[model samples]
Target: MKRLNILVTGGAGYLGSMISTKLIEIGHNVTVIDILEFNKTSLSHLFVKKGFKFIKADVRNKKLLKNLVKKKDIIIPLAALVGAPLCDKHPKKTKEINFDTIRYILSIIKPSQKMIYPNTNSGYGIGKKNNFCDEKSPLNPISLYGKTKVDAEKIILKHKNSVVFRLATVFGYSFRMRTDLLVNFLVNKAVVDGEIKLFEPHFRRNYIHVLDVANAFIFAIKNFSRMKGNIYNVGLSTANLTKLELAKLIKKYVSGTKIRIIKNRKDPDKRDYFVSNKKIEKLGFRPSVSIEDGIKELNYIYSNFNFKKNKNNY
Candidate 1:
Protein backbone atom coordinates (compact mmCIF):
# COMPACT_ATOMS: atom_id res chain seq x y z
CA MET A 1 0.00 0.00 0.00
CA LYS A 2 1.21 3.49 -0.82
CA ARG A 3 1.96 5.69 2.18
CA LEU A 4 -0.78 8.32 2.52
CA ASN A 5 -1.22 11.47 4.58
CA ILE A 6 -4.29 11.09 6.81
CA LEU A 7 -6.07 13.68 8.96
CA VAL A 8 -8.17 12.45 11.87
CA THR A 9 -10.34 15.09 13.57
CA GLY A 10 -11.13 14.36 17.24
CA GLY A 11 -8.19 11.97 17.14
CA ALA A 12 -7.92 11.72 20.92
CA GLY A 13 -11.44 10.38 21.29
CA TYR A 14 -12.46 6.76 22.01
CA LEU A 15 -12.74 5.75 18.34
CA GLY A 16 -10.18 8.26 17.03
CA SER A 17 -7.45 7.18 19.45
CA MET A 18 -7.62 3.60 18.22
CA ILE A 19 -8.04 4.47 14.55
CA SER A 20 -5.15 6.98 14.47
CA THR A 21 -2.76 4.53 16.13
CA LYS A 22 -3.68 1.76 13.68
CA LEU A 23 -3.13 4.07 10.71
CA ILE A 24 0.35 5.05 11.90
CA GLU A 25 1.25 1.39 12.54
CA ILE A 26 0.43 0.62 8.90
CA GLY A 27 3.07 3.24 7.82
CA HIS A 28 0.63 6.04 7.04
CA ASN A 29 1.59 9.58 8.04
CA VAL A 30 -1.18 10.49 10.48
CA THR A 31 -1.90 14.04 11.69
CA VAL A 32 -4.51 14.15 14.47
CA ILE A 33 -6.36 17.34 15.45
CA ASP A 34 -8.43 17.30 18.64
CA ILE A 35 -9.47 19.72 21.37
CA LEU A 36 -8.88 16.93 23.93
CA GLU A 37 -12.34 17.33 25.46
CA PHE A 38 -11.90 13.98 27.22
CA ASN A 39 -8.25 13.06 27.77
CA LYS A 40 -4.92 14.58 26.75
CA THR A 41 -2.88 11.43 27.32
CA SER A 42 -4.85 9.24 24.93
CA LEU A 43 -2.50 10.11 22.05
CA SER A 44 0.60 10.75 24.15
CA HIS A 45 2.22 7.51 22.99
CA LEU A 46 1.75 8.52 19.35
CA PHE A 47 3.77 11.70 19.88
CA VAL A 48 7.07 9.80 19.79
CA LYS A 49 6.28 8.04 16.51
CA LYS A 50 8.06 9.48 13.46
CA GLY A 51 5.04 9.79 11.18
CA PHE A 52 2.47 10.74 13.84
CA LYS A 53 1.67 14.38 14.69
CA PHE A 54 -0.88 15.82 17.12
CA ILE A 55 -2.45 19.29 17.00
CA LYS A 56 -4.68 20.56 19.79
CA ALA A 57 -7.45 22.46 18.01
CA ASP A 58 -11.21 22.37 17.68
CA VAL A 59 -12.68 20.96 14.44
CA ARG A 60 -15.04 23.93 14.37
CA ASN A 61 -12.06 26.27 13.80
CA LYS A 62 -12.56 26.86 10.10
CA LYS A 63 -9.28 28.65 9.37
CA LEU A 64 -7.09 25.99 10.94
CA LEU A 65 -9.30 23.15 9.60
CA LYS A 66 -9.14 24.42 6.01
CA ASN A 67 -5.34 24.54 6.08
CA LEU A 68 -5.21 21.03 7.63
CA VAL A 69 -7.77 19.55 5.19
CA LYS A 70 -5.82 20.58 2.11
CA LYS A 71 -2.69 18.59 3.04
CA LYS A 72 -4.29 15.21 3.77
CA ASP A 73 -5.03 12.52 1.18
CA ILE A 74 -7.56 10.79 3.44
CA ILE A 75 -9.73 12.40 6.15
CA ILE A 76 -11.55 10.62 8.96
CA PRO A 77 -14.01 12.87 10.87
CA LEU A 78 -14.58 11.33 14.31
CA ALA A 79 -15.30 14.65 16.07
CA ALA A 80 -18.84 14.76 17.50
CA LEU A 81 -20.97 14.86 20.64
CA VAL A 82 -21.39 11.06 20.60
CA GLY A 83 -24.40 9.82 22.58
CA ALA A 84 -28.05 10.91 22.93
CA PRO A 85 -27.67 12.10 26.52
CA LEU A 86 -24.51 14.07 25.78
CA CYS A 87 -26.07 15.62 22.66
CA ASP A 88 -29.18 16.57 24.64
CA LYS A 89 -27.04 18.19 27.32
CA HIS A 90 -25.34 20.50 24.81
CA PRO A 91 -27.66 20.77 21.79
CA LYS A 92 -26.02 23.87 20.33
CA LYS A 93 -22.45 22.47 20.47
CA THR A 94 -23.80 19.19 19.09
CA LYS A 95 -25.11 20.89 15.94
CA GLU A 96 -21.92 22.89 15.38
CA ILE A 97 -19.55 19.96 15.82
CA ASN A 98 -21.57 17.04 14.45
CA PHE A 99 -23.34 18.59 11.46
CA ASP A 100 -21.69 21.93 10.77
CA THR A 101 -18.09 20.71 10.92
CA ILE A 102 -18.88 18.02 8.35
CA ARG A 103 -20.51 20.55 6.06
CA TYR A 104 -17.42 22.73 6.28
CA ILE A 105 -15.07 19.84 5.53
CA LEU A 106 -17.08 18.86 2.44
CA SER A 107 -16.93 22.40 1.11
CA ILE A 108 -13.11 22.55 1.26
CA ILE A 109 -11.81 19.05 0.41
CA LYS A 110 -10.74 18.34 -3.14
CA PRO A 111 -12.56 15.72 -5.21
CA SER A 112 -9.42 13.58 -5.26
CA GLN A 113 -9.17 13.35 -1.47
CA LYS A 114 -10.99 10.42 0.19
CA MET A 115 -13.26 10.87 3.20
CA ILE A 116 -14.40 7.95 5.38
CA TYR A 117 -17.08 9.00 7.89
CA PRO A 118 -18.32 7.06 10.93
CA ASN A 119 -22.09 7.32 11.27
CA THR A 120 -24.09 5.54 14.00
CA ASN A 121 -26.68 2.89 13.08
CA SER A 122 -29.08 4.48 15.61
CA GLY A 123 -30.39 6.44 12.64
CA TYR A 124 -32.35 3.34 11.74
CA GLY A 125 -34.71 4.19 14.57
CA ILE A 126 -37.21 1.46 15.42
CA GLY A 127 -36.53 -0.84 12.47
CA LYS A 128 -39.05 -3.53 11.52
CA LYS A 129 -39.25 -6.02 14.42
CA ASN A 130 -38.20 -9.14 12.53
CA ASN A 131 -36.15 -7.59 9.72
CA PHE A 132 -32.55 -6.41 9.57
CA CYS A 133 -31.85 -2.79 8.59
CA ASP A 134 -29.46 -2.60 5.65
CA GLU A 135 -27.72 0.27 3.83
CA LYS A 136 -30.88 1.14 1.88
CA SER A 137 -33.07 1.19 5.00
CA PRO A 138 -34.94 4.45 5.61
CA LEU A 139 -33.31 6.46 8.39
CA ASN A 140 -35.65 7.80 11.09
CA PRO A 141 -33.29 9.34 13.64
CA ILE A 142 -35.09 10.12 16.92
CA SER A 143 -32.39 12.00 18.85
CA LEU A 144 -30.44 15.13 17.96
CA TYR A 145 -27.27 13.01 17.90
CA GLY A 146 -28.66 10.56 15.36
CA LYS A 147 -30.36 13.29 13.33
CA THR A 148 -27.14 15.29 12.84
CA LYS A 149 -25.18 12.20 11.81
CA VAL A 150 -27.90 11.12 9.39
CA ASP A 151 -28.10 14.60 7.91
CA ALA A 152 -24.32 14.76 7.60
CA GLU A 153 -24.33 11.36 5.92
CA LYS A 154 -26.85 12.57 3.30
CA ILE A 155 -24.51 15.36 2.14
CA ILE A 156 -21.38 13.21 2.49
CA LEU A 157 -22.81 10.63 0.07
CA LYS A 158 -23.26 13.31 -2.53
CA HIS A 159 -19.48 13.61 -2.72
CA LYS A 160 -18.54 10.60 -4.85
CA ASN A 161 -15.13 10.26 -3.14
CA SER A 162 -16.77 9.75 0.25
CA VAL A 163 -17.44 6.40 1.98
CA VAL A 164 -19.74 6.15 4.99
CA PHE A 165 -19.84 3.33 7.54
CA ARG A 166 -23.10 3.07 9.54
CA LEU A 167 -21.42 1.61 12.61
CA ALA A 168 -23.26 -0.43 15.24
CA THR A 169 -23.02 0.15 19.01
CA VAL A 170 -19.24 0.14 19.47
CA PHE A 171 -17.71 -1.62 22.51
CA GLY A 172 -14.24 -2.57 23.82
CA TYR A 173 -11.50 -0.60 25.63
CA SER A 174 -9.63 2.25 24.01
CA PHE A 175 -6.84 4.55 25.25
CA ARG A 176 -9.77 6.87 26.03
CA MET A 177 -11.98 4.15 27.50
CA ARG A 178 -15.69 4.95 27.46
CA THR A 179 -17.58 3.25 30.29
CA ASP A 180 -20.78 4.91 29.09
CA LEU A 181 -21.19 2.67 26.01
CA LEU A 182 -23.84 -0.06 26.42
CA VAL A 183 -21.72 -3.23 26.66
CA ASN A 184 -18.92 -1.43 28.53
CA PHE A 185 -21.43 0.26 30.90
CA LEU A 186 -23.30 -2.96 31.66
CA VAL A 187 -20.07 -4.84 32.26
CA ASN A 188 -18.81 -2.04 34.52
CA LYS A 189 -22.09 -2.11 36.49
CA ALA A 190 -21.81 -5.89 36.86
CA VAL A 191 -18.14 -5.77 37.94
CA VAL A 192 -18.51 -2.83 40.35
CA ASP A 193 -22.04 -3.11 41.74
CA GLY A 194 -22.61 -6.86 41.08
CA GLU A 195 -26.11 -6.03 39.78
CA ILE A 196 -27.77 -4.51 36.70
CA LYS A 197 -31.28 -3.06 36.29
CA LEU A 198 -32.61 -3.54 32.80
CA PHE A 199 -35.25 -1.31 31.22
CA GLU A 200 -36.46 -2.15 27.69
CA PRO A 201 -34.64 -5.46 27.91
CA HIS A 202 -36.32 -6.72 24.76
CA PHE A 203 -35.07 -3.83 22.65
CA ARG A 204 -32.65 -5.18 20.04
CA ARG A 205 -29.42 -3.60 18.74
CA ASN A 206 -26.16 -4.48 16.97
CA TYR A 207 -22.55 -4.17 18.22
CA ILE A 208 -18.89 -4.17 17.09
CA HIS A 209 -15.53 -3.94 18.79
CA VAL A 210 -13.66 -0.62 18.80
CA LEU A 211 -10.66 -2.29 17.14
CA ASP A 212 -12.90 -3.69 14.42
CA VAL A 213 -14.33 -0.23 13.85
CA ALA A 214 -10.74 0.99 13.41
CA ASN A 215 -10.02 -1.86 11.03
CA ALA A 216 -13.08 -0.97 8.96
CA PHE A 217 -11.60 2.49 8.42
CA ILE A 218 -8.30 0.92 7.37
CA PHE A 219 -10.18 -1.45 5.04
CA ALA A 220 -11.93 1.46 3.37
CA ILE A 221 -8.60 3.26 2.96
CA LYS A 222 -6.96 0.27 1.27
CA ASN A 223 -9.97 -0.38 -0.95
CA PHE A 224 -11.15 3.19 -1.39
CA SER A 225 -11.67 2.92 -5.15
CA ARG A 226 -13.84 -0.18 -4.82
CA MET A 227 -15.87 1.01 -1.78
CA LYS A 228 -16.19 4.73 -2.47
CA GLY A 229 -19.53 6.44 -3.19
CA ASN A 230 -21.33 3.86 -1.01
CA ILE A 231 -22.65 3.16 2.47
CA TYR A 232 -21.82 -0.07 4.37
CA ASN A 233 -23.13 -1.40 7.70
CA VAL A 234 -20.14 -2.29 9.89
CA GLY A 235 -20.82 -4.73 12.76
CA LEU A 236 -20.42 -8.24 14.13
CA SER A 237 -22.74 -10.61 12.27
CA THR A 238 -23.05 -13.01 15.24
CA ALA A 239 -23.91 -10.33 17.81
CA ASN A 240 -27.17 -8.53 17.01
CA LEU A 241 -28.74 -9.51 20.34
CA THR A 242 -31.32 -7.77 22.55
CA LYS A 243 -30.66 -5.83 25.77
CA LEU A 244 -31.61 -8.78 27.98
CA GLU A 245 -29.51 -11.10 25.84
CA LEU A 246 -26.54 -8.73 26.19
CA ALA A 247 -26.99 -8.48 29.99
CA LYS A 248 -27.18 -12.28 30.20
CA LEU A 249 -23.99 -12.55 28.16
CA ILE A 250 -22.26 -10.21 30.63
CA LYS A 251 -23.57 -12.29 33.55
CA LYS A 252 -22.11 -15.39 31.91
CA TYR A 253 -18.68 -13.72 32.06
CA VAL A 254 -19.08 -11.86 35.34
CA SER A 255 -20.31 -14.53 37.74
CA GLY A 256 -22.70 -13.73 40.66
CA THR A 257 -24.03 -10.67 38.84
CA LYS A 258 -27.78 -10.26 39.27
CA ILE A 259 -29.96 -8.99 36.41
CA ARG A 260 -33.21 -7.21 37.31
CA ILE A 261 -35.84 -6.20 34.78
CA ILE A 262 -37.90 -3.18 35.79
CA LYS A 263 -41.54 -3.09 34.72
CA ASN A 264 -43.55 0.07 33.85
CA ARG A 265 -40.34 1.96 33.03
CA LYS A 266 -38.72 2.98 29.76
CA ASP A 267 -35.18 3.60 28.57
CA PRO A 268 -34.74 7.16 27.27
CA ASP A 269 -32.69 5.77 24.40
CA LYS A 270 -35.42 4.35 22.16
CA ARG A 271 -33.10 3.10 19.36
CA ASP A 272 -34.28 -0.48 18.75
CA TYR A 273 -33.11 -2.26 15.61
CA PHE A 274 -31.17 -5.25 14.32
CA VAL A 275 -28.50 -4.39 11.72
CA SER A 276 -27.15 -6.41 8.77
CA ASN A 277 -23.39 -6.51 8.19
CA LYS A 278 -23.81 -8.50 4.96
CA LYS A 279 -22.88 -5.51 2.84
CA ILE A 280 -19.45 -5.01 4.40
CA GLU A 281 -18.94 -8.74 5.04
CA LYS A 282 -19.23 -9.34 1.30
CA LEU A 283 -16.34 -6.91 0.85
CA GLY A 284 -14.19 -9.28 3.02
CA PHE A 285 -14.06 -7.13 6.19
CA ARG A 286 -14.81 -9.18 9.34
CA PRO A 287 -14.78 -8.03 12.97
CA SER A 288 -12.30 -10.01 15.08
CA VAL A 289 -13.56 -9.32 18.63
CA SER A 290 -16.81 -10.82 19.97
CA ILE A 291 -19.13 -9.28 22.59
CA GLU A 292 -17.84 -11.91 25.00
CA ASP A 293 -14.28 -10.75 24.36
CA GLY A 294 -15.27 -7.10 24.93
CA ILE A 295 -17.05 -8.01 28.21
CA LYS A 296 -13.98 -9.88 29.46
CA GLU A 297 -11.74 -6.97 28.41
CA LEU A 298 -13.88 -4.40 30.26
CA ASN A 299 -14.13 -6.68 33.30
CA TYR A 300 -10.33 -6.81 33.49
CA ILE A 301 -10.00 -3.01 33.17
CA TYR A 302 -12.72 -2.01 35.69
CA SER A 303 -11.70 -4.72 38.14
CA ASN A 304 -8.08 -3.54 38.31
CA PHE A 305 -8.21 0.20 37.57
CA ASN A 306 -9.96 2.72 39.84
CA PHE A 307 -11.36 4.92 37.08
CA LYS A 308 -13.25 7.03 39.62
CA LYS A 309 -10.07 8.66 40.95
CA ASN A 310 -8.38 9.03 37.58
CA LYS A 311 -8.28 12.53 36.10
CA ASN A 312 -8.37 11.29 32.46
CA ASN A 313 -11.97 10.59 31.50
CA TYR A 314 -12.69 6.89 31.40
Candidate 2:
Protein backbone atom coordinates (compact mmCIF):
# COMPACT_ATOMS: atom_id res chain seq x y z
CA MET A 1 0.00 0.00 0.00
CA LYS A 2 1.11 3.56 -0.75
CA ARG A 3 0.10 6.95 0.61
CA LEU A 4 -1.38 9.26 -2.02
CA ASN A 5 -2.55 12.86 -2.34
CA ILE A 6 -6.31 12.87 -2.99
CA LEU A 7 -8.51 15.71 -4.21
CA VAL A 8 -12.28 15.66 -3.70
CA THR A 9 -14.09 18.33 -5.74
CA GLY A 10 -17.39 18.42 -3.82
CA GLY A 11 -16.08 17.65 -0.36
CA ALA A 12 -18.81 19.35 1.67
CA GLY A 13 -21.87 17.54 0.32
CA TYR A 14 -23.30 14.28 1.70
CA LEU A 15 -21.19 11.59 0.03
CA GLY A 16 -18.23 13.88 -0.60
CA SER A 17 -17.88 14.73 3.09
CA MET A 18 -18.02 11.06 4.04
CA ILE A 19 -15.47 9.94 1.46
CA SER A 20 -13.11 12.85 2.14
CA THR A 21 -13.06 12.07 5.85
CA LYS A 22 -12.42 8.41 5.06
CA LEU A 23 -9.47 9.25 2.84
CA ILE A 24 -7.92 11.49 5.47
CA GLU A 25 -8.45 8.89 8.22
CA ILE A 26 -6.63 6.29 6.12
CA GLY A 27 -3.47 8.44 5.85
CA HIS A 28 -4.05 10.05 2.46
CA ASN A 29 -3.40 13.77 2.06
CA VAL A 30 -6.83 15.13 1.00
CA THR A 31 -7.63 18.51 -0.52
CA VAL A 32 -11.35 19.32 -0.85
CA ILE A 33 -12.60 22.12 -3.10
CA ASP A 34 -16.26 23.07 -2.72
CA ILE A 35 -18.34 26.17 -3.40
CA LEU A 36 -20.16 25.62 -0.09
CA GLU A 37 -23.61 25.99 -1.68
CA PHE A 38 -25.10 24.17 1.28
CA ASN A 39 -22.66 25.48 3.92
CA LYS A 40 -19.29 24.59 5.44
CA THR A 41 -20.43 22.75 8.58
CA SER A 42 -20.27 19.31 6.97
CA LEU A 43 -16.49 19.80 6.72
CA SER A 44 -15.93 21.67 10.01
CA HIS A 45 -14.63 18.52 11.71
CA LEU A 46 -12.10 17.89 8.92
CA PHE A 47 -10.48 21.31 9.30
CA VAL A 48 -8.78 20.19 12.53
CA LYS A 49 -7.61 16.88 11.08
CA LYS A 50 -3.92 16.37 10.29
CA GLY A 51 -3.98 15.62 6.55
CA PHE A 52 -7.01 17.56 5.30
CA LYS A 53 -7.27 20.84 3.40
CA PHE A 54 -10.38 22.74 2.24
CA ILE A 55 -10.66 25.25 -0.59
CA LYS A 56 -13.73 27.29 -1.46
CA ALA A 57 -13.87 27.30 -5.27
CA ASP A 58 -15.90 26.13 -8.26
CA VAL A 59 -14.69 23.13 -10.33
CA ARG A 60 -15.40 25.06 -13.55
CA ASN A 61 -12.89 27.73 -12.55
CA LYS A 62 -10.33 26.69 -15.15
CA LYS A 63 -7.63 28.92 -13.69
CA LEU A 64 -7.75 27.15 -10.33
CA LEU A 65 -8.60 23.61 -11.53
CA LYS A 66 -5.76 23.59 -14.08
CA ASN A 67 -3.23 23.96 -11.27
CA LEU A 68 -5.17 21.83 -8.73
CA VAL A 69 -5.72 18.75 -10.95
CA LYS A 70 -2.02 18.60 -11.72
CA LYS A 71 -1.07 18.32 -8.04
CA LYS A 72 -3.05 15.20 -7.00
CA ASP A 73 -2.66 11.49 -7.65
CA ILE A 74 -6.40 10.82 -7.74
CA ILE A 75 -9.40 13.10 -8.45
CA ILE A 76 -12.86 12.24 -7.12
CA PRO A 77 -15.43 14.51 -8.80
CA LEU A 78 -18.46 14.56 -6.50
CA ALA A 79 -19.50 18.16 -7.15
CA ALA A 80 -22.78 18.22 -9.02
CA LEU A 81 -26.41 19.36 -8.77
CA VAL A 82 -27.48 15.84 -7.79
CA GLY A 83 -31.04 14.42 -8.15
CA ALA A 84 -33.70 15.02 -10.81
CA PRO A 85 -35.67 17.94 -9.37
CA LEU A 86 -32.59 20.06 -8.55
CA CYS A 87 -31.15 19.32 -11.96
CA ASP A 88 -34.51 20.24 -13.45
CA LYS A 89 -34.51 23.55 -11.58
CA HIS A 90 -31.03 24.41 -12.90
CA PRO A 91 -30.49 22.61 -16.20
CA LYS A 92 -27.62 24.81 -17.38
CA LYS A 93 -25.74 24.47 -14.10
CA THR A 94 -26.35 20.75 -14.19
CA LYS A 95 -24.76 20.45 -17.60
CA GLU A 96 -21.83 22.67 -16.69
CA ILE A 97 -21.11 21.22 -13.26
CA ASN A 98 -21.99 17.56 -13.79
CA PHE A 99 -20.82 17.08 -17.40
CA ASP A 100 -18.68 19.93 -18.70
CA THR A 101 -16.54 20.15 -15.60
CA ILE A 102 -15.44 16.59 -16.23
CA ARG A 103 -14.69 17.57 -19.81
CA TYR A 104 -12.55 20.42 -18.53
CA ILE A 105 -10.70 18.15 -16.09
CA LEU A 106 -10.12 15.56 -18.80
CA SER A 107 -8.36 18.19 -20.84
CA ILE A 108 -6.10 19.41 -18.02
CA ILE A 109 -5.35 16.21 -16.08
CA LYS A 110 -2.37 14.09 -16.98
CA PRO A 111 -3.04 10.55 -18.25
CA SER A 112 -1.12 9.24 -15.22
CA GLN A 113 -3.59 10.75 -12.75
CA LYS A 114 -6.30 8.28 -11.76
CA MET A 115 -10.00 9.22 -11.47
CA ILE A 116 -13.05 7.80 -9.73
CA TYR A 117 -16.37 9.19 -10.95
CA PRO A 118 -19.85 8.68 -9.44
CA ASN A 119 -22.31 8.15 -12.25
CA THR A 120 -25.99 7.75 -11.28
CA ASN A 121 -28.29 4.71 -11.52
CA SER A 122 -30.99 7.04 -12.90
CA GLY A 123 -29.27 6.53 -16.24
CA TYR A 124 -31.04 3.17 -16.40
CA GLY A 125 -34.31 5.00 -16.87
CA ILE A 126 -37.21 2.59 -17.40
CA GLY A 127 -34.97 -0.46 -17.77
CA LYS A 128 -35.79 -3.76 -19.47
CA LYS A 129 -38.92 -5.35 -18.08
CA ASN A 130 -38.45 -7.72 -15.10
CA ASN A 131 -34.67 -7.83 -15.48
CA PHE A 132 -31.85 -6.33 -13.45
CA CYS A 133 -29.65 -3.80 -15.27
CA ASP A 134 -25.92 -4.46 -15.55
CA GLU A 135 -22.91 -2.50 -16.81
CA LYS A 136 -23.83 -3.61 -20.34
CA SER A 137 -27.39 -2.34 -19.97
CA PRO A 138 -28.28 0.48 -22.31
CA LEU A 139 -28.47 3.89 -20.62
CA ASN A 140 -31.67 5.64 -21.70
CA PRO A 141 -31.77 8.42 -19.12
CA ILE A 142 -34.91 10.57 -19.21
CA SER A 143 -33.91 13.44 -16.93
CA LEU A 144 -31.29 16.13 -17.46
CA TYR A 145 -29.49 14.94 -14.30
CA GLY A 146 -29.24 11.34 -15.40
CA LYS A 147 -28.28 12.26 -18.97
CA THR A 148 -25.46 14.50 -17.80
CA LYS A 149 -24.06 11.82 -15.48
CA VAL A 150 -24.12 9.26 -18.28
CA ASP A 151 -22.28 11.66 -20.57
CA ALA A 152 -19.68 12.38 -17.89
CA GLU A 153 -19.13 8.68 -17.24
CA LYS A 154 -18.38 8.14 -20.90
CA ILE A 155 -15.66 10.78 -20.84
CA ILE A 156 -14.10 9.52 -17.62
CA LEU A 157 -14.15 5.88 -18.76
CA LYS A 158 -12.19 6.81 -21.87
CA HIS A 159 -9.50 8.40 -19.70
CA LYS A 160 -6.69 6.01 -18.78
CA ASN A 161 -6.64 4.65 -15.20
CA SER A 162 -10.14 5.93 -14.44
CA VAL A 163 -12.99 4.05 -12.66
CA VAL A 164 -16.73 4.60 -12.71
CA PHE A 165 -19.37 3.64 -10.15
CA ARG A 166 -22.95 3.97 -11.43
CA LEU A 167 -24.33 4.67 -7.97
CA ALA A 168 -27.93 4.13 -6.82
CA THR A 169 -30.02 6.50 -4.69
CA VAL A 170 -27.79 7.20 -1.70
CA PHE A 171 -29.42 7.33 1.77
CA GLY A 172 -28.53 7.48 5.47
CA TYR A 173 -27.64 10.42 7.75
CA SER A 174 -25.09 13.00 6.74
CA PHE A 175 -23.83 16.25 8.28
CA ARG A 176 -25.43 18.00 5.30
CA MET A 177 -28.88 16.41 5.10
CA ARG A 178 -30.87 16.08 1.89
CA THR A 179 -34.64 15.47 1.88
CA ASP A 180 -35.07 15.19 -1.87
CA LEU A 181 -33.71 11.63 -2.06
CA LEU A 182 -36.51 9.01 -2.06
CA VAL A 183 -35.66 7.10 1.14
CA ASN A 184 -34.46 10.13 3.07
CA PHE A 185 -37.50 12.17 1.96
CA LEU A 186 -39.98 9.42 2.86
CA VAL A 187 -38.35 8.76 6.23
CA ASN A 188 -38.35 12.50 7.05
CA LYS A 189 -42.04 12.81 6.14
CA ALA A 190 -42.92 9.72 8.14
CA VAL A 191 -41.10 10.91 11.25
CA VAL A 192 -41.94 14.63 11.22
CA ASP A 193 -45.14 14.93 9.21
CA GLY A 194 -46.52 11.42 10.04
CA GLU A 195 -47.63 10.85 6.45
CA ILE A 196 -45.92 9.73 3.25
CA LYS A 197 -47.27 10.53 -0.20
CA LEU A 198 -46.44 8.44 -3.26
CA PHE A 199 -46.93 9.49 -6.86
CA GLU A 200 -45.85 6.11 -8.28
CA PRO A 201 -46.09 3.35 -5.72
CA HIS A 202 -44.67 0.60 -7.92
CA PHE A 203 -41.65 2.49 -9.22
CA ARG A 204 -38.57 0.50 -8.21
CA ARG A 205 -34.94 1.65 -7.79
CA ASN A 206 -31.74 0.66 -6.00
CA TYR A 207 -30.31 2.31 -2.86
CA ILE A 208 -27.01 2.39 -0.93
CA HIS A 209 -26.03 3.88 2.39
CA VAL A 210 -23.91 7.02 2.32
CA LEU A 211 -21.15 5.19 4.21
CA ASP A 212 -21.29 2.28 1.81
CA VAL A 213 -20.91 4.72 -1.10
CA ALA A 214 -17.79 6.09 0.57
CA ASN A 215 -16.54 2.55 1.10
CA ALA A 216 -16.94 1.84 -2.61
CA PHE A 217 -14.63 4.75 -3.39
CA ILE A 218 -12.11 3.54 -0.84
CA PHE A 219 -12.19 0.10 -2.41
CA ALA A 220 -11.57 1.57 -5.85
CA ILE A 221 -8.73 3.77 -4.61
CA LYS A 222 -7.02 0.77 -3.05
CA ASN A 223 -7.55 -1.43 -6.12
CA PHE A 224 -7.35 1.10 -8.95
CA SER A 225 -5.22 -1.03 -11.22
CA ARG A 226 -7.75 -3.84 -11.59
CA MET A 227 -10.79 -1.55 -11.42
CA LYS A 228 -9.78 1.08 -13.95
CA GLY A 229 -11.59 1.47 -17.29
CA ASN A 230 -14.64 -0.46 -15.97
CA ILE A 231 -18.09 0.58 -14.70
CA TYR A 232 -19.66 -1.07 -11.66
CA ASN A 233 -23.20 -0.85 -10.28
CA VAL A 234 -22.53 0.16 -6.67
CA GLY A 235 -25.63 -0.76 -4.64
CA LEU A 236 -27.17 -3.40 -2.41
CA SER A 237 -28.85 -6.25 -4.25
CA THR A 238 -31.37 -6.75 -1.42
CA ALA A 239 -32.34 -3.07 -1.40
CA ASN A 240 -33.99 -2.85 -4.79
CA LEU A 241 -37.41 -1.64 -3.64
CA THR A 242 -40.40 0.52 -4.65
CA LYS A 243 -41.76 3.76 -3.16
CA LEU A 244 -44.65 2.16 -1.27
CA GLU A 245 -42.49 -0.69 -0.07
CA LEU A 246 -39.98 1.88 1.21
CA ALA A 247 -42.79 3.71 3.06
CA LYS A 248 -43.78 0.51 4.81
CA LEU A 249 -40.18 -0.01 5.93
CA ILE A 250 -40.09 3.51 7.39
CA LYS A 251 -43.38 2.80 9.15
CA LYS A 252 -41.71 -0.01 11.07
CA TYR A 253 -39.27 2.42 12.66
CA VAL A 254 -41.63 5.39 12.99
CA SER A 255 -45.00 4.13 14.11
CA GLY A 256 -48.32 5.46 12.70
CA THR A 257 -46.69 6.64 9.48
CA LYS A 258 -49.52 6.96 6.98
CA ILE A 259 -49.05 6.41 3.25
CA ARG A 260 -51.09 7.96 0.44
CA ILE A 261 -50.88 7.17 -3.26
CA ILE A 262 -51.87 9.69 -5.89
CA LYS A 263 -52.99 8.55 -9.31
CA ASN A 264 -51.44 9.84 -12.58
CA ARG A 265 -48.89 11.95 -10.71
CA LYS A 266 -45.51 11.84 -12.45
CA ASP A 267 -42.16 11.70 -10.66
CA PRO A 268 -39.73 14.39 -11.67
CA ASP A 269 -36.85 11.90 -11.82
CA LYS A 270 -38.79 9.15 -13.68
CA ARG A 271 -36.21 6.42 -12.89
CA ASP A 272 -37.42 2.83 -12.42
CA TYR A 273 -34.91 -0.05 -12.43
CA PHE A 274 -32.92 -2.59 -10.41
CA VAL A 275 -29.10 -2.75 -10.72
CA SER A 276 -26.67 -5.70 -10.57
CA ASN A 277 -23.51 -4.95 -8.60
CA LYS A 278 -21.76 -8.21 -9.48
CA LYS A 279 -18.77 -6.56 -11.12
CA ILE A 280 -17.71 -4.64 -8.03
CA GLU A 281 -18.63 -7.56 -5.80
CA LYS A 282 -16.28 -9.75 -7.80
CA LEU A 283 -13.56 -7.18 -7.25
CA GLY A 284 -13.73 -7.63 -3.42
CA PHE A 285 -16.21 -4.86 -2.54
CA ARG A 286 -19.78 -5.40 -1.34
CA PRO A 287 -22.28 -2.95 0.11
CA SER A 288 -22.75 -3.58 3.83
CA VAL A 289 -25.77 -1.34 4.53
CA SER A 290 -29.36 -2.42 3.87
CA ILE A 291 -32.33 -0.11 3.39
CA GLU A 292 -33.73 -1.39 6.68
CA ASP A 293 -30.49 -0.43 8.47
CA GLY A 294 -30.50 2.93 6.69
CA ILE A 295 -34.04 3.51 8.00
CA LYS A 296 -32.84 2.78 11.53
CA GLU A 297 -30.02 5.30 11.14
CA LEU A 298 -32.48 7.91 9.82
CA ASN A 299 -34.83 7.22 12.72
CA TYR A 300 -31.94 7.89 15.10
CA ILE A 301 -31.02 11.15 13.32
CA TYR A 302 -34.58 12.46 13.35
CA SER A 303 -34.92 11.56 17.01
CA ASN A 304 -31.67 13.22 18.10
CA PHE A 305 -31.10 16.19 15.79
CA ASN A 306 -33.24 19.29 15.38
CA PHE A 307 -33.30 19.21 11.59
CA LYS A 308 -35.00 22.05 9.74
CA LYS A 309 -37.11 19.75 7.62
CA ASN A 310 -38.32 20.88 4.20
CA LYS A 311 -39.84 18.76 1.41
CA ASN A 312 -38.83 20.82 -1.63
CA ASN A 313 -35.02 20.94 -1.23
CA TYR A 314 -34.59 19.70 -4.81
The number of the candidate with the highest lDDT is 1
Looking at candidate 1, the ten consecutive residues that score lowest on lDDT are: 305-314
Runs off by more than 4 Å, candidate 2: 125-127, 309-313
The C-alpha lDDT values of all candidates are: 0.90, 0.86
What does the lDDT read for residue 270 in candidate 1?
A: 70
Q: Which residue window of length 10 is worst by lDDT in model 2?
A: 305-314
Off by over 4 Å in 1: 125-131, 309-314
Q: Which digits, one per residue and each the tens of the lDDT, describe model 1 over residues 1-314?
A: 78899999999999999999999899999999999988779999888898998999889999999999999999999999888888988899999999999999999999999999999888675656655699988778788888999999999999899999999999999998787888988998999999998888998899999999999999999888999999999999999899999999999999999999988897665768888889889989989998899999999999999777543222
RMSD of each: 1.6, 1.6
Model 1 alpha-carbon miss at residue 308, Å = 2.0
Cα error of candidate 2 at position 268, Å: 2.7
